[model samples]
Target: MAKRPEVVPDILDWYAESARDLPWRAADRTPWGVLVSEFMLQQTPVSRVLRPWSAWLERWPAPAALAAEPAGEAIRAWGRLGYPRRALRLHAAAVAITERHGGEVPDDHEALLALPGVGAYTAAAVASFAFGRRHVVLDTNVRRVLGRVIGATAYPPNHQTATERDLAEQLVPADPARAARWAAASMELGAIVCTARNPACGRCPVADRCAWLAAGRPDNAPPRRGQSYAGTDRQCRGALLAVLRDADEPVVGERLDLAWPAAVQRERALAGLLADGLVVRVGERYALP
Candidate 1:
């Protein structure tokens, strides 16, 4: 008989014994709760997502609650989460949910994908986690796990491509409940043990079957690109949004100038925010809409 699959069982068993008892994983977590958690988890750590997620679920509890409020509340609620744009997107998604799905997070993949901020990864995650659908839920952790388990690399060359998705789907266990748990478990292993740098292979459950170990743990891949944050428009945008989010009423252009030193970049950032619908201009003042 062919070699028994190692990663799935090892990961599931490890997760069964070791997975963190997160608030979102509670028995009473609603679909809205799952949606909010997924959005918060994007490019953010689980540690960071916890408190805010709990507070958000406690405050809103449903799409209608968030949808009824101004976008500024979401931005403020986001609070140092990094990538505040996701807050705006979540707010828009809430509005969309209210209008389209009668304030319920749709269970179907296509409908979920159509939400303002719900992309493929988030859509699949909600479907699997909330509804327990059998779908290949690929995230950064899952991608890295697959990379080491099969390709002997830290991560796939360029994220989840068609080939990568096919590989992930092939690895997903047949049962829906087990498959969801396996996806979360594989991600947990990659996050805590099979980390990008200085991986703790000894602690990894699937270390016995890891191709990267078989290949002598070589770093054959190029270093990932560094992001430029200083002097970028993103900083300017953040500063502008901070001012707007704190204000009770729309801010004048002159008021926004206090946030940034560069006038031109500040103007550009405010204009971009207006175009993005994150901010609305009333005569000369800007406020979250």
Candidate 2:
């Protein structure tokens, strides 16, 4: 508390020795690759994104390449990564990068933020990871690690606060490259060791410095619950989208009905997809958009 937390160096050392060999982190990885990985990684696990990301970059290695294609192609290629909207947004972002930034993922945080579908968190992530500029890259994993280590909270607030932002900013190293490394290191620590449930405390590099561990690791203020999937509208949506994704061409509305059992739920999900621009009505058939 008096000085920088003693755990910082330990976490960095662990990261250097233990980081996953992700394609996005490869020395040869392009800025476009990093941007694409970031977009695919939101809410979805790394395991699911690996094949898709590889094939995608292989197909469209640069912003200009993806921007040249129809947005619907991006959706079809997305292939059940859960939120297909991200694919559309990434396509839009690619278009912006191609037209406005001349086919380059801009290094400036503000410029990245200006791209379609790029939010504050994404802007900071792209700037720090891709460009190696100092910024507080607070993703969900980073927030959980910080909450436990510094605030002794089992979980962070549902919404990030001004106080949380100030703490995160103070924790970032002043040197751009060092700050970027720390940002990544802390996030990795959260994802692999300080997990949401059944954290491997014995494996954590900063177990000794963690305020939550020292405080007996009390329960969350409310409670933590795993997300539900069965019978949800999200499940219905995925089912409907999967049918469209696999089709070689636009299929009749009747063909889509075969994908899901509940007619009313299927119709609602279909309407929602149309609204989100993830699906399109072509004459009497539905198709990916």
Candidate 3:
């Protein structure tokens, strides 16, 4: 068994003071709000999500309201958040909620996971934050923090195993309220202090207990590969979506043709978007459907 760090308490204590008071975390946040927040946070940064989340909650305060609207609105509402599929998936989730859960977010983890966009992280988050259940909320940030504080190296190649889950559960404070805060704190610590690149160890509350530091911070066996974004199909899709998101009406192929010049990449991008149901073609014009 790996030796656990002792400074988890200090980290959580520091997080209580430093964590951002996000709008989605307002005292009046309903289960619907929590669900929306988890969706918006996927692949999008906190600063980018703030204004949009506020606007979304203000416009559609419940799943029923969102379900009543066309899914295109959700995609347009997502703005430059990237990964527009999340918006479509969220719309489907709203519809499922209205049909299955009486327009209310499900409290049960299994029921939540059954939703279109909801997954393990989201289900556990909603369960803990909105429903006050004890569950290990593991995200990339949590995994990084746990890996450094205990293993003194990068995370393993695959997802967390049963043993890792048990260890995380053990570290969760027994008090439900505090445990929820602790989980969020661990995530925040990993995001801001114990980050993936050039971690701010000087500012970290758990530095003293970090096994990575104790082991002299040796470079791991190999460097992780970085993802390529430029000239990729994803970049072209985003460029195409940007135009659709801003257009008040459907745009013709000529207009979209102007966004990207490469014929092959442009056709591939358009086909991918069409296949993803992000855009619909009426005659020669394209628009969000």
Candidate 4:
């Protein structure tokens, strides 16, 4: 196994050479930009987020800009980002930031955590990447990297745990700036090389030190079940949302019914959407809130 001191520097060197040129990682990117990217990235691929992120930054620019608009505008601008509810939450977060933080994305980790949709991962990412603060920053990528390199596991637990959080905190460097860099580097390495499936161990910078590789990379965990979208309520919801997003006014109940053929599933989907506050009833019609 590689020396503890060498792991972070090796990952940082690898990241310096191979990191993707995402806009949010640019030298000039703002705290607001990082916040927006974090929200857009939840469960969405980087490739799919690129255009929407660019357009969103161009249109909104800052928290105050998005705060000025109606929640529906944010939903409409979300385009086809899948989880449209995030758009609503992001808009609400912007309003909170504007009202409470003087329109600036707060630099404090706790303050960032208090934002509407901001969670532990987002808060740590924004604090480290945007403000150059020392933090654990354990996103899926970071967690996967740590799992193989340090924990000798094929995969991390299905959910984050107190033990995982403590380990991550210990792995973070003492120097604030370097810890921030390590956060980004480790995450980048996991995303591109130490991937969940078909990990490119040959290309990994810390392959020599990887405990999982040293142990012959055993597959102790069962295969994760792939989620199906077709004919599911999620698919039904997406279809119903697409129609409302495209319409300039509240859509009639019958118009929404045309989005899905199965009466039971359609009603269930609409009910779920309404329950989730993604859609609202407007007299006899429905609209995005």
Candidate 5:
């Protein structure tokens, strides 16, 4: 196995040359841009986010800009990103940032967490990636990559554990700038090379030190389940929302009826959206909240 000290540097050096030219990671990117990217990226692919993210930043360059618009406008701009609730939450977060932090995205991690819809991961990510602060930004990619390199796991747990948190904290570099870079580097490595399936072991910088590789890349974990979207309530929800999202004004019941084929599933999905505050009743018409 490769020495622990060398593995970190190897990954870092590899990232220096290989990191994707994401807009959020650009030198000119603002804290607000990073925060917006974090919101748009939740469970969504980078490819799906790129255009929407650019449009969002263009329309609302800062927290104050988004906060100035109706919450529904955010939902309209969200496009087909799947989870429409995030649009409402992001609008709320923008209001909080404007009211609480004077239009600037908070630099302090705890301050970031205090924002509406801001969680531990989002807070740490904004702090580290935007402000260049030390933090364990352990998103799925970071967790997966480190699990293989350090813990020899074929896959990390479905949910992060206290043990994983402790291990990640210890793995973070002590220097603030380097730690921030490490956070982005590790996540990038996992995304491009050390993917969840079909990891390119030959291209991995730390392959020599990967405990999972040294152990012959055993699939010791139980078989993972894949999520089904077709014919699911989630698919119905997306369909119904698409009608409202595209309409110039609130849509009537008949409009939503054409969105989803099944009467029962359509009603159930629309009800769920209304309950989740992604949709609202405007008289008899339904519209984004």
Candidate 6:
């Protein structure tokens, strides 16, 4: 069995050579940049986030800048990111940062967690990656990597557990800098090599030390189900939002009616958008908010 400490150096060295040059990971990347990246990356792919992130940062470089904009502007700027509520929450977070944190993304994990959309994984990621603090930083990628390398599991649990948290804390290096690097490296390995499906074990740096590999990589019982997007209320909401996003003026109720054919579903979807604060009602029209 490979000792847990032995894994860090190999993973970090491989990361040094193979890590993707993501904009958020650049030396000059700001805490705000990291915060924005974290929010945008939620359930969205890196490839889709790149352009929108660039545009967003260019427009609102700081928390104060974004706070000055209306929530509608933030939603419009979100631009097909999906789950547009993240934009509203992010806008609220920026406003909170400007008012409470003096326009700075706080380095403290607790402070980061207090932000509107920031959660456990995001707070840890910002503290470790942006500030080089020692934190577990266990996102889906990191969880998957740790599950395979240490737990001998083909997949991590559907939700995080105390055991997983304790394991992550135990495995993370005590040295703050090394721990931060380990967080990024482990996540990168999972993202690019130890992927969810068809993992490239040959390219993994710690393949020899992986428990799952040693155990012959048995398939996960009760295979993970993929999310369905077609013809769902989510799709209806997206279509309605798309029309509003592209319009110059508040769209008529009749216009929104064209988005989804099923009257009940469309109404439910629109109501959901309104409830989510992603849309606003103006007289008989609706607009992004």
Q: Which candidate number has the best TM-score?
A: 6
Worst 10 residues of 5 by lDDT: 1-10
Residue 52 lDDT in candidate 2: 99
Q: What does candidate 6's lDDT look like per residue over 1-289, in tens digits?
A: 2347688889999999999999999989999999999999999999999999999999999999999989999999999998988999999999999999989899999999999998989999999989999998888998898888887888998889988888888889999999999999988998999999999999998899899999999877653677897989888999999999999899898888887789999999999999999999989888887
lDDT of 3: 0.86
Score candidate 2 by TM-score against the native: 0.95
Give per-residue CA lDDT, model 4, range 152-177, as digits (tens): 88888788988778877877899999
The whole-model lDDT of each prediction reads 0.85, 0.89, 0.86, 0.90, 0.89, 0.91
Model 3, residue 153: distance off in Å is 1.0
Residues 106-213, model 3: lDDT tens digits: 988899999998889999999888888777898888877887788788554355777667678778888888878877889889888888788899998878888888
Model 1 pairs in collision: 251-285
State how far residue 213 of model 3 sits from its true place (Å).
1.3
Once fitted onto the true fold, the runs of candidate 1 whose alpha carbons sit more than 4 angstroms away are 1-4
Q: Residues 13-122, candidate 1: write the lDDT tens digits.
A: 88989888988889998999999999999999999999999889889999999999988899889987888889999999999999999998999889999998899989
Question: Which scores greater on TM-score, model 3 or model 6?
Answer: 6
Candidate 3: list runs displaced more than 4 Å.
1-6, 154-163, 221-223
lDDT preference between candidates 3 and 5, better one: 5
CA shift of 259, model 2, Å: 1.8
Poorest lDDT segment (10 consecutive residues) of candidate 1 = 1-10
> CA RMSD for every model?
2.1, 1.7, 2.0, 1.8, 1.8, 1.5
- Per-candidate TM-scores read 0.94, 0.95, 0.92, 0.95, 0.95, 0.96
